[model samples]
Target chain A: MKSALSTLLQQTADLRQAIRHKSHTGVTSGLVQGAMQGNVVILPADWANEFLLFCQKNPVSCPLIGVSEVGRYDMPELGHDIDMRHDIPEYYVYRDGVKVESRSDIEDIWQDDMVAFVLGCSFSFENALSQAGLTPRNVEEAVNVSMFETNIETVPAGRFFGNTVVTMRPYTPKDAIRAIQITTRFPKAHGAPLHFGSPQDIGISDLSKPDYGDAVTINDKEVPVFWACGVTPQVAIRNAKPPICITHAPGKMLVTDILDTALAVL
Target chain B: MKSALSTLLQQTADLRQAIRHKSHTGVTSGLVQGAMQGNVVILPADWANEFLLFCQKNPVSCPLIGVSEVGRYDMPELGHDIDMRHDIPEYYVYRDGVKVESRSDIEDIWQDDMVAFVLGCSFSFENALSQAGLTPRNVEEAVNVSMFETNIETVPAGRFFGNTVVTMRPYTPKDAIRAIQITTRFPKAHGAPLHFGSPQDIGISDLSKPDYGDAVTINDKEVPVFWACGVTPQVAIRNAKPPICITHAPGKMLVTDILDTALAVL
Candidate 1:
């Protein structure tokens, strides 16, 4: 008999097929149960090396999983026929580090000098946390996870330098402990939180107002647990100001064929 | 040339010598830096089988490490010449399930039908917690750990049936999470905490007043974290009401020759 995870993959393969036909283009968070979802960043050949260095410098914020050679849209390591231009839900086009356009696909924008990099996402650890009986509040609410800009600085690489972006998950002290234990197992998916209690300590001013994504409910006892977000690279990319760049829209990740457990350090 | 752990052991050996001589019959909380100190429970042969079943039933609270043969009075597996009578600096004598006396030694009460059981203590996990930068508060305050009786009852074995006794360590939500991760690695040392957060949620009425030991200061930002303590077995022993029972009194544990690292499951 097929395992439940195998069943999740069978359904995910069908969903990916729909995505391939451009009939389904949305956030892929709950689509694949056990497969790894990734944040996508595309840059020109001249800027790719520096961005790769940026990811290497700040692994917790931007854990680089697959780096495609310049002008190569094919990602054989991540999946079969995984075209960079059309596999994702949405794309954010950046010119001189400023977001210029948002599109469902990037076929026409694909450039020969462009190189694609796949980064491990916080969502990779979400499954682990849930499995450990610390289901994140955002998952229960069925919303985009609350994210914020933190005072914690990311390591600089050439022109790339900015404060990190962090995803927030509110948990009671007990659940938060379980969450920490769960997340620590996945080092590639941002090993552990930068800070947990009193968001102000990490320079987050307001709990009600988030920098990105849909906000979820925080119970009276729940404290916001902040994890280094994959969106951190977009902030760094903005600081670098490459003439032309493309990335998966925040929260709309590139769902890959890789298993989430494969990314766990232990 | 010697490793720091080896040097630390040399110092611990010195402390153990003092402990053995009844010259240092105090809490062994911080005495031997990294040695595997244990909770000692000695019972008459007629009751030893029942206590062994209790340990087997409630492995977390009473993690059985070494169980000696009846009338053996020695534990080569734990250490050379670990006499149940003289090894533990302080011993608690229970008659009809009541703690009747506290003694520095139990040589006079030693019996030919007695068997000693060495159980893993939370101190083993505390060492791991401290090394991971989540030092338990009890160790830092230099006091006997604050312990509480919980509503959560342990599985019964023979005549033994009682609720668990847990030790509390206060930490901010973040550190609590890290502590959970650190402690999970030492299942032999009570593994992960049974509960945390609101004390009343687990039938703990007041944080200030404890059932046993000293209460340490808990900052407003910190939440009390509780783990299944070594003291749980004493409560079980009290409930079992064997005509006579003996255990290492409070924090004055049996300092074994075994290394703490040797007990680490991971």
Candidate 2:
């Protein structure tokens, strides 16, 4: 049974490889469905300890899944022979937390002192929601999910803290409640919502002008439900002003062999 | 350990008895604090089946914890020997789901074919919320919790179907989200909130004119938080229009011996 499950999961890895080969490079949203995907954060060893503590303090924002040995390119626990450099369709390099460049791989920039932290992503629960008959609108529209920054404070760690960044999904109050319940089962994926209803309540001035990703239509009867974004710790990293940091560009996630059901608490 | 827990629970029984004796007959707020108290519903066996199905369909509203066998009044699991006739400080006798009269006890009205259902009450979570340092304003002010009937529909079960009734507590949208997280852990006590923010969205035109219970303050910065109510099934019972039914008067509930921990999912 384990081998059978593993065989099915390898197919997911094969699909991710296809996406990596530019055969399926476009957002990787619906491909390899039902597998848990992760947001990648790689940083120098000097800032790695502080960033680990930051994720511990602000778990809702950065749920850490696997941490690689210093300078190690292999994230064996995340997937079989997962290469951090080329697996992601895109990458972001930040200097002092400001985006400096984008690349398809970082083999040349790879350093022995760098540590890769695999944080859980909302795409995990997005799959669960869709399976439960509440398909997320962003998935239906074939767009990157909207992202926003909220005033809600994250627990501060040494030189690593910022307000939580949240991803927005429009849901009717009824659907929003169900979404809250469904997302809660996957705590590693920014469990539950940080806020719902008015944008003003969370220091958000407008729904249309999102800080990152495209804003989808929020129907009149629906409210924009907010979940702590996987990118939140990235914001914290930016504020921390690390010498060098790398991340999977938004919407380009690290597909893992883990099944979404493996994370359910209930 | 069982005996020790039971010994601790005896204190609650003592307080409940004191309330019945008029030695402790206020709102029962903060009385016997940690013990699980329940909303009481009593009905003739003929109407009991439908009401049972209603509670089954509307678990958030009428979470049936212990059901007394027809023609019996004992609930050993809830208490050592809880006498339904005079145990509660208050009681409301409903004829056809419309409350007709109330009394301290109904030994005279107690029927041979009557069955009793005791549901986990919101007070269980009030204790939890208070401990978490988010005690509601109504509890702080020593007033009845405000309740409203909503346009949200309940799953229909035979003749027992009506829009859900919800209790209102005011909190900023951010805090309301926390409350939803906290209360979602207690499914026996209504689970997460049904709606928040707009009263009109759920077909409630006025927040001030609550259909049941007293209205409380809703500050400007705060959004009105709503949860499924213990009284929701009572409203459905009214719609069902049974020949006879009895329930604990509003704010009055059956004191049970069960520890609140018994109901917690996590």
Candidate 3:
């Protein structure tokens, strides 16, 4: 008989294996219930230093969970037997600030001078939110969380500079308040939302149209709560015009063995 | 040379002394800045039991900081040499749910069977908010917080039943998020807000007019955030129709020696 913790860990490892072998190649949103998922960003050693400074300057938007050594794909700090090159369900290749290709495995393109960075994702906190009975609308609708580019600017580090990208979740004011308290506990996963209520207030002119990801229904009684999105770094990378870069595709992410509770801070 | 804590304690003691001697009859909103303040409620021993149950039923609005034993006026746990009859800056006397008189001291009316209850006030969290640079509008304007009667009802306990009262503070969405995290630390002082945004959603028809306190300015970019108020219990007691009830006038609270940080949990 496996302990509950052991079973959850085993399940997470099994799911990662499926993703590693290309058996599970869809969005990783609702899979492996308690495990933490990460947004993948791989950069050449030269670009990695400036990107690290960008993350330090804008921590709320880019909470780095693990940074692999140059040329190494394994992020042992975040998971067991993790291979960043083959673990993520989907990957996107960027050349000179433009997204040029999307693929499943990055093993063929892996470079000795590249460094892998795993960032804490909002998906990790969704489980905690759902367990608190404040299930986010994106989870209920079974679609990607709505992402919008806000006028709020991110701090510049070297050439990395761009407006912030936020993920919105519609909730009633009462439920939103509880959501704020619950999410504030996970600072590594974007902490609490940057804004709530009117979309225009945050320079998001249209709730129906988003800059990235799929938009969910916003009921009449619900107000949109916006959290700083991990996609923000990608926008900065485009502005920085790094020569070569690779990242996980929009909904797909790397499943790590770390439990969601491990990301919580006081 | 006195320590900073010693000076704050002396200042609080002197202020309480002034309030006790009938020298200070106005509101206690901004005075004795670092100490905990409480809403005063006095009732006969028979009514105290039901009121206690009511406090338990609605702890957010009626956080019990201290309760005097029957016939006792001093709350030693809350402060040294505290006399409930004279500690509050001003007192309201109610007879069968109706206002009878307003007085500076209740020493003459203090009955042998009366029990004095001290409930936590939101003023304590104002210091925490101000320290975080999210100075509440009421503090900035030097006025009582804008309080309103909401449609949200409290849990019924015996005859004590009425709508929950809430205090409003206006802030930009960003500041409100920080305020929420800062105030959540002090659970005994109403924790986080009950709601934010549209006033009408919580039964408040106007932001310019409040039922209990003076309304502060709501800038074009700001949204009004509402927190459960200590006055809620007073409304409950009024509905209960206690034969003889004494309470602190709105904004005039019992200044206790306990530090504001003492109420913080996590």
Enumerate the candidates' DockQ scores in order. Answer: 0.41, 0.59, 0.81
When summed lDDT is taken over every stretch of 10 residues in candidate 1 chain A, the lowest stretch is A8-17
lDDT of 2 by residue, A2-120 (tens): 78677768787896687567575556666677788898999999899988998998888899999999988889887887888778888899998888998888889998899999998
lDDT of 2 by residue, B9-72 (tens): 7787787678667675546656677788888888889888888888888898888898999988
lDDT of 1 by residue, B12-115 (tens): 66666776687888888866767888998888999988888998989989999998988887888877666768878789999889999999888888888998
Question: Which residues of candidate 2, in runs, are more than 4 Å off?
Answer: A1-4, A153-161, B1-7, B96-98, B155-161
TM-score, B chain, candidate 1?
A: 0.95
| Candidate 1 Cα outliers beyond 4 Å, as residue runs | A1-14, A130-135, A170-175, A204-209, A218-223, B1-17, B205-210, B217-222
lDDT of 1 by residue, A1-266 (tens): 99876776676566667776789877777668678888999999898889989999999899988989789988889876788888887889999999999998888878889999999998998888888888778788888888898888999999999999999999876677667777888878887887777888788998778898878888886778899999998998888999988998888888887899998878
What TM-score does model 3 achieve against the real structure? 0.98
Better of 2 and 3 by TM-score: 3
Error of 3 at B226 (Å): 0.6
CA displacement after TM-score superposition, residue A164 of candidate 1 (Å): 2.8
TM-score per model over all chains: 0.89, 0.91, 0.98
Question: Which candidate gets the maximum TM-score versus the true structure?
Answer: 3
- Let me know the DockQ for model 1: 0.41
